[model samples]
Target chain A: MNDLARTIEALLFIAPEPLEVATIQDITGEGPDGIAGALEEVRGRHGPDTGLELAEVAGGWALRTRGDLAAACDALRARPREDRLSPAALETLAVVAYLEPVTRREIGRLRGVDVDSTVSSLLDRGLIEEADRPHAGPTTYRTTTAFLERFGLARRGDLPTLERFELTGPEAGALRARLEHADLIAEAETGDA
Target chain B: MRGTNPAEGRAGDAGNLGGVPARDASAALTQEVEIDLFQGPFDLLLTLLLRDEVDLLELPLADLVEEAVTPATDERWEIDAASQLVLLLAAIADLKGRRMLGEEVEDEPDADALAMREALVGRLVAYAPFQRAALWLADRLRAAERPRYRRVPPGTATPVPVHDDPARLSAAIDRMVVAPPAPSLAHMGVVRRPLPELLVRLRDSLARLREVSFDRIVADCDRLEEALTLLAALELVRRGEAELRQDVPFGDILITGTRA
Candidate 1:
């Protein structure tokens, strides 16, 4: 690779977070076309067989452990992680993820619960943040790039649809039975006799 | 399996409802059976039930109310959870009753009831996608084998210390917002009269009275102006336009202009 590509690779390697192309341009004094070409070169250099892959995640370039090597890495070192999302947290995050720049009231309205603590927890984890704009309305929140990085998504559009979690055969059967029971109880209690 | 309900055997196993009579089993079903799909705040249970296609109008409200007010378990009820659950159930029950009443009496459906139902169903519908997304996220987290790499690990960096005193911060901002009292120019050095202007003025004064004593020229002048007058007298002497004489120590010098 040429000097530009090598320099870009070095910068991405050393950066604590993903490096944006504009940042690379600022540092290297390279034009957009030149930087794009160098990034492509850097990406190409890290082929599938390589341990680390140059991934474009969270709107920037990052060097990440290859998906297949994750198991081996886990065996090599037990990385300290406290990122497990509880069921409540996942639900709150899902609401924020899909309907972002949303207010606490809007989230509560949809989830049918108060989400104050959940919102604060997400904020502390750096997975979501308050939108920084002046307005007369209440404060709003949106997912951070850290959310995408942790979930291995390149962008919000990469998120899977909710249809994937739609109740399947057995699960659907169980829910149907519960509904039937509720109907029966309603009839018996209302003096249907 | 279709003819025989297995949930019947499992019913007694649910929360302290073992001795519940057959007549009250349905109420037990509503109150005791914990949903296996998702667990969260009691408020979310309504949406999950809605997602499962349980008609809100058909929910066993009277029986559920009995179960809520006097739960079968000896365990202390979470007051917040119980109160919120009762509030939601009451709202749904009210909506159900009004809709039924409208169907019986009114030729046209009640707009208020329709709006309320629409809002409730709309919340359910909107929340359904996120419920599914949450499951997907959980699955993704479980399946992810390798955590992302970091050259410098997170949480290692020292956090920037913050001054968190609200009153002081407010005062600081208030001080900034109101334009500072127009900066005092008293301490600033500003020449009221330029040396050149003073020099010209002194020469003109000498011309007006050719032999004026230095003390008379500076009688009304300040210290700075007095110093400037002395310099101007020297400049005149340098050009041979004036002469200075002091007969006694610490006496004022006399100036004599050369011009007629």
Candidate 2:
């Protein structure tokens, strides 16, 4: 497009992580409006038809392979398979995402299970970070920008609404029974061992 | 302590039941009956009970408890499962006992018991949805799997020199690992001149000429001697034994013996 847009595009091309508008402004000495316009122009250059698109992730812009081409590119690259988040890890992440600045105690209490290992795993993965609290107490955790980027979410508000997961009286009963049954099966198997 | 069926190898069979994908009504309905049946599957019975089709007082839990506690062949009891069973059994017994006591003669149920149940249900409700949400996020993670470009830091591209000679390399490595020889101070000489001796010398020179240029007193002197002469002159001036004058900046200083 224009000169500023071209410069911003080149910067994005070289950046390892998504580059924020403020950072671009700092580097270019451009005002907010100018930077915003340039970013828009840069984004316009890569449409759905293009192999690479400018993705706005974690409040920053980055050029990445198009969403649909991810599998093909992955195959071509033949890189080691990325470690997928375990179900337990994901559940813990969801807990942190929803009830951020939450303590380990609260997460454990809600899940009705120990979450020490799970919480540490999420921390190691950079999906969650310890929140800074002025008052002294047990540590609290919250989802990080990395978490948003990984999940491809614009913000916490963009998470799917919880209404669909609400359980009716019968449904709740069924779920409880299911949990109990699973527990029973596990106990039986362990005893057999 | 009911015995387990290891021979049946039902562990593999259980995998088919899925892990808490309870949203599938048909699979849940079919698999709900296949697990253990306490008067035709506890889940189905619980559903009917919650829907008010079955009465708490008429649950026939005494027989269920007897069956639950009976020891089967070649089995051991796990405390967790036993404790869970006890809690469930106790809760059911409490509800039945309270209902039988005719505490309200029927209008309202026990608030404390209802609160406890509600709390348990509330926790499950809050947590279960997140499991599904996590799966959704995982799908998004899969979709967003594109390569990102990063700037290769400057000066990192140069390769480190390789030393092929083993003995030289070993010696080099040993040199690196060993503490370096204490820095040599043999080349440096410490010179100290007595201040009083220099003062006497300056006094003699200033007296011999009555008035002498300050630079002339230390003309052939080294740095230490010059520093000592300057200090001695300042001391003599402070004592009112001599007066020194500088005509301009960077000009020679003239020292005159006031004692004369």
Candidate 3:
């Protein structure tokens, strides 16, 4: 490996969170485009059969253990985590994730319940956050990077596919793009059932 | 499930020689309304219409509105979406009645009831995607959020959002929503115990004595005045006007002047 690739790997190893391309540039005193090349080299070295792999998550690059070793690491550490979210929290989180930039009133309407406690719980857990839009009335919210991290997604746009295999709705042919999410999944999210 | 048997249940209830108790009817109503809450409002409406094999656009507005507003589905999320649907139905029915009658332009109000009906149709059409997306995302999260570690990128050097204290996070959110104070009045009248005064005091006190405890230095200070004096002393130390020493963690911090 070259000097730049080694430096980038070391930097990723030391970083406590995902490092954006811009941040790497500031520290490395290299151009954005140049750092991209180095990142590719470092990522290439840590592939299958390696202990770790480089990932681009939450719109930034990070180095993490390969997926296969997760169980082994947890077993070795014996770290028991009490992190299962309540059903109400999961429902509330789903709303914020998909209909983000949505206000509390909008969420309440969708869920048909007062979501004050659930909202507070999600906020405390670093899942959803106030978008703080300059609106006249109540506050609005959006999901955070931590939310994506918890759900094992690279970014917000990578939400799972809900498309039905068959399309037979009235506007299916004409409104294909608009009605993309309307397909009925055979066995979709557990909550949906 | 209720959609499949609404008629049968109603038929069964009607056949009763003895009228059902008020409590049983209300309990059944609450249970029915609870069913509609989880299913998106648009999806529920579509299901009800589809169960009767009715056309979507040419909906029976009056019948649907009566069902929605009255105790059919037990109205909840009633404040926003339920009410909106009821309003839209009323507006559509009124518009249909007006068209049946003559168009009275002079007496007509400016709300454009026809336009409101069109908007409601558009909204219901738009909601199909949201319902699917919500289910999609929820299933994805449920699958991913197990206790086991999920592969992710290496974190940055300083973790900004990784604070243990939720109060700080909440405070940061609160600050964002609130308007900041004007800079003109900032620190306007803080009774600053001048750094020079603390420096002179430290110089004189240290001159008489080799070193003094932080408490002894601020012994004369009253209430919050000690904080100001400490701030001044720190400023003096920053400028090499004084020195502070500590023998151990959580131990007494000492303040003294330059040996000259």
Candidate 4:
């Protein structure tokens, strides 16, 4: 088990991007149960003593700079902007990413704003692409692989959950509950009546 | 890859070194700017904010917004590019005013204020991830990227069939209608052999045999002629001169001459 854990640790350490348990299993030929146990062991190995973190991002395991050191590692992550997208462009991109194979008209409805300039900018940037529609309806857009890489995501399915962000109806109830929980925590900390 | 601290600075260095793999041939037709001066107003503000490291909540967003918008106040500002930023400013003002005013009205907190804050917060929360994504993309773009020129000349796209001019589109449809109705199977003209002739051929062939296989009869014929023969055979069977038998539906059909 320790040997398996060590091997998993080394693989996770060297990987540029996150690796899935299945990918590790393919290489190691371990069952999912065994792989999960080994990963747990590997996670234990990356405890308080080390700066390297064995964390799951986008449904895969990756070695990232530990959260405590994120501030110090900003320089490592920071890179110059060549051609950046504006907030509207970025919002349009988010809409396209969340609701992929999405029509421009549909995106317009979701954003409640015109997306003409933003759509063209995304096209020029190679971030989002015009997906071919089988029927001659409005052209739908999908995020390119370039988009996944740009966002540091392994796949489109790895997009961060937007239901909470939508902050609508039932999701608002969840948010309210979350606020109540925070209030409880605050009350506990204050020792107030 | 060895027992080294491979965490120093190799985030996105592996891929095509920051080059705009322009592989787009038709891009030449569109006048391309060498480098975008700035992506737009929001990106400009983000770049400014990223450079300054100002705390978003504490910082007066209105000042930065005013500075950004002031240039555009004359004939300079683009409505498309800067409208969202202005709206953002309005939201910021609303939030700031609410924060100041709503604190005093703690006894009866306004629902509108909370809702406005939630809306703005939600947008910012949503916008934050994309901003980070844009930054990453921008970084990748900054890395040693060279635009690849196209080797082959770009082919002209077929003219768009749908046009705003209804007359022109209808004229195009009219032209299509007028043009020699698609030369259409004319070169291989139809050869309609009489059904009675096929019936006579079948009668002569099946006279000795108790039964004849439909496939074997049509095996030597071309597709069109073979189809005609099959139809003629079916017609003969329908007329009761021959009986059709198949052990299984869709299996090989057998046509036997009726003794009667």
Give per-model TM-scores.
Answer: 0.48, 0.51, 0.42, 0.34
In candidate 1 chain A, where is summed lDDT lowest over 10 consecutive residues? Answer: A184-193
Q: In model 1, which runs have C-alpha deviations exceeding 4 angstroms?
A: A75-77, A156-181, A186-193, B1-122, B143-145, B153-260
Q: Which stretches of model 4 miss by more than 4 angstroms?
A: A67-85, A124-126, A130-138, A144-193, B1-260
State the lDDT at A168 in candidate 2.
66
What TM value does the first chain of each candidate achieve? Answer: 0.79, 0.80, 0.75, 0.63
User: For residues B67-138, what per-residue lDDT tens digits would candidate 2 score against the true structure?
Assistant: 544433323333444455555555556556656777432222357645755677678777777777777777
User: lDDT per model, in order?
Assistant: 0.68, 0.69, 0.61, 0.58
Higher-DockQ candidate of 2 and 4: 2
Candidate 4 interface RMSD value: 16.1
Compared with the true structure, what per-residue lDDT tens digits does model 1 show for residues A45-113?
998878888877788888877877776887866777656789999999888887788999999888898
Q: Is candidate 1 or candidate 4 better by TM-score?
A: 1
* Alpha carbon deviation, residue B208, candidate 4 (Å): 70
Ranking by TM-score: 2, 1, 3, 4
Per-residue lDDT, model 4, residue A113, is 71
Expressed as tens digits, the lDDT of each residue in B35-121 for candidate 1 is 333333333455444354455556666655544455544333333344444445654565457556663322223577446555655
Candidate 4 chain A lDDT trough over 10 residues, lowest sum? A184-193
Error of 4 at A140 (Å): 2.2
Candidate 4 lDDT at A26 equals 81
- Which candidate model has the greater TM-score, 3 or 4? 3
lDDT of 2 by residue, A1-193 (tens): 8899999999888676778888888789999899889988887898888887877788888877776775677675565667888888887887788788999999998778999999988889898999999899999999998788877776655677766655667877766665544433343343335
Error of 1 at B22 (Å): 26
Off by over 4 Å in 3: A80-82, A86-88, A156-193, B1-135, B138-260
- The DockQ assigned to candidate 3 is 0.08
